[model samples]
Target: MDNYSVKKLSKLAGVSVRTLHLYDKMGLLKPSVRTEARYRLYGEKELLRLQQILFYRELDFPLKEIGAILDDPAFDIVQALEGHKKALLARRERINTLVGTIEKTLVTLKNNTMLQVEDLYEGISPEKVQAWRTEAMAKWGKETVLEAEENLRSFSKEEMDGLKTELNDNITARLTALMHTDPKGPEVQELIARRYQIILRLTGGQIKMEKLEYFRKLGELYVEDNRYTPVNGMPSMELALFIKEATDHYVSEQKK
Candidate 1:
């Protein structure tokens, strides 16, 4: 097996030597060999581990949690890579949707034209969207509700449709597929954690993911009142319960 010095491996991995040292310090990545001068020497195994580290980092995983995950006894490199592919693909779709929204918003601004209400929310009824505005205005002051509507002006009809597709077809579909898995499992928790941020954005920060009880309450809203039924591609009680239980577990873990 080829062995590389710390500096050499750093250059190869596009990471700083100091970063490698920090990883070593955190017990996240350890070199396999030591030279006569007690210098760090990394092998192929280290290279693969570093690759995994970078992959999780790209997914916004914290370094400490990444270490815990990588060191888990049940960790499987092949499985992890497959999960990474799915997550990255989902993220790419969201990014593409946002970019399209931005482009459309620019065009609308330049033309000084506005999208029709029916087109703004393509799949859903315009009246329903208007009802949502009215309800939001009642719950949270009118200014906040108006500001949230103003933000939606940036999304084109197609981008609005893409957001719906991404949420239902991509995120929800994947979560439904994992419904058979343990809610407390890494895959389930990780997926739900990402979904939490999406929910905050969807609500225009009107619903904060700040408190544990509030966070779990949103999940409860899924099955109880079908409050999120409109946007979540719902009617699956099992999937809704899975999300509720999973988010509850995730919130518990976060507190720890």
Candidate 2:
């Protein structure tokens, strides 16, 4: 049986070596064999197992949840793949709607045209946005709600949409920059610090490490709410996960 080293496997799988190590430590993946020197080696079986793992991760399953799902002896791999296919298709549809909305808005802006109120609400329901505001206020406090609402309401609907789109792009850019960075590296920690600073500014300094962790834990619940998750094409859960992971590393280092 052919076997690949961790480096080779990571390259083939398009994931970081650090991520692979974390997966192994989490028991989400394991090497098929170990050399006399204790080097991990992955064979065909490991590759298939990793494929399933990656698929679940891509579907946004938390590592723990994915571990439980894959560890069950009765787990039907084929059925899971079929289910995943359906989910992926649904996700694609949602992204398409969000992307189309953004594209249309961009077209309007480029032409210096003011969008109609109906067009402003394209791919979004005002009721749902209101519900999001309600939930956010309940969780974060009335003051936080009032601030966000006051700031957001100042923008016209088209302008608000543009702000959301720009924020999304900024998040993606920052995360992508951090993706290849070592979690323990000084550069990455600096980026994390910058992120924490922004968070603090937004929360008016009420969001420290303890409160931040609390918010992070409840984040998935917010994402479960359709009003939050399907906004602007990206799942808010995904953003939450990214922030959680980045901050987890930072906090761990800061304590030490």
Candidate 3:
């Protein structure tokens, strides 16, 4: 039977020898054979186990969890591989969409041309946008929602890009930074006030004092919607909640 020494296995597996030793220490993986010289050697069975460990690692499974799963008597290698394939395919689809969005953004930048509404919201699904629009209309009335959408559409590509950049770099950055701070603090409230102004601008200054509640509701939607939870490529439910709290605080202050 063919066997591999620790050094050989490390080279074959593209993992460091120290890593293999650590895995052995952790009882996560162990060589199948120990020679008279106390040298560790891995056989075919150990190779297969190492493959399984790497597969689990690729899926971002915790080392302890992977060890538990692999050591489970009911664990089926074939089923695990099949599940991994499905997850990888889904991840690939999302990556492709983000790539397309980036390409469109690049083209708009290179040509200095206006982007269509769809292009502006490139990676977001039209169905999702429509669903949000429907919900907005139901809550705020058709005229309010349509007017907001029209106002957004009226912007040139450069203006639209600038607005997105400001949201990401200014508003989102500040909100994310203050995630650990008190949401009702002066700094957070100031940021929330700026965010409210930006929203009003997006709505062509249509938002009035009476419609301020809409801004607070919009903050809630940021937490409730998975799409809005990710800002500037980072996902943080905490940040979304922080924004919602700050908006609520801002609105409460307005009432006083």
Candidate 4:
């Protein structure tokens, strides 16, 4: 098989040699073979893998996640890339909404009209918007409705998706580990505790009773939502099963 040296490959691919070296070190790419002088040579297969890596990197996937995704036999690169394009387009729409909101804010300021938070978000999903409105009414009363609306307007779709992806990956990775071991077992509980800490840290260390309830809801969301399935693959599912057993054990022991 024909092979190109690292320098040659980098030049051909329009990427820096240093970038190629880093990918090699990260195990995201490997040479097809090494010459007698120990120089790296990459072939067609490596080039295709490099293309896959570049595509995922363009979508802002962390290098580590990219590696795991590329290594997965079940991972469909074309399908994933299509999904990423859809996500990017959705983000673009949110940016347009934000721009419109800013324009509205300016007009309100110029006209001396009182601008409320609700006016800031011109577009929000009907279901979530209604839920937020309901929650705001219940918690802060109608008087502070603008405050909740303002907070909702602070995040764009890209920002929200990024946050969700990070959290989902992190929780899935930890939960998958916890599921493998006994939940009643100290080690498993320790893992759960660590996850609890992660949740707290994500919430800026304000893990109050309501926030704990929120965490429970988040877990239920995983069941209600299939978003967890992709990150928590087979191994992760195995881990969840183990964790459930451990939790049962702990509960039964508590009754003793």
Top candidate (lDDT): 3
- Where model 1 places Cα greater than 4 Å from the true spot, the runs are 1-115, 199-231, 234-256
lDDT of 3 by residue, 1-100 (tens): 4379889899999999999999999999988878899888898889889998998898876798789788898877677668868978999999999999
Residue-wise C-alpha lDDT for candidate 4, range 58-105, written one tens digit per residue: 778778879978899887877766877898899999999999999877
Structure candidate 2, residue pairs in collision? none
Stretch of 10 with least lDDT, candidate 4: 233-242
Candidate 1 per-residue C-alpha lDDT over 1-256 given as tens digits, one digit per residue, 9 for 90 to 100: 6478888999999999999999999899988977789899999999999998998888776798689778997867577667877978999999999999998778776434323434444456667767865765675567754554455554443444455567677766666666546533566455554555554444333444464345544544442453333546631222223344445566786789
State which candidate, 1 or 4, has the greater TM-score. 1
Model 1 CA lDDT for position 133: 55
Best by TM-score: 1
**Cα-lDDT of candidate 1:** 0.63
lDDT of 2 by residue, 1-256 (tens): 6478999999888888898789888888888788899888898887888888888888776788678787998878678668878988999999999999999787666434322322323456778756755666666566744554333233444544454465456643554455456434555444344444444332234457664554444333433342222323532222333344445555776689
What is the lDDT for 43 in model 3? Answer: 89
Instruction: Report, for all candidates in order, the number of backbone clashes.
Output: 0, 0, 0, 4
Full-model lDDT for every candidate: 0.63, 0.58, 0.65, 0.58
Question: Candidate 4's C-alpha lDDT?
Answer: 0.58
Q: Which 10 consecutive residues of model 3 have the lowest summed lDDT?
A: 233-242
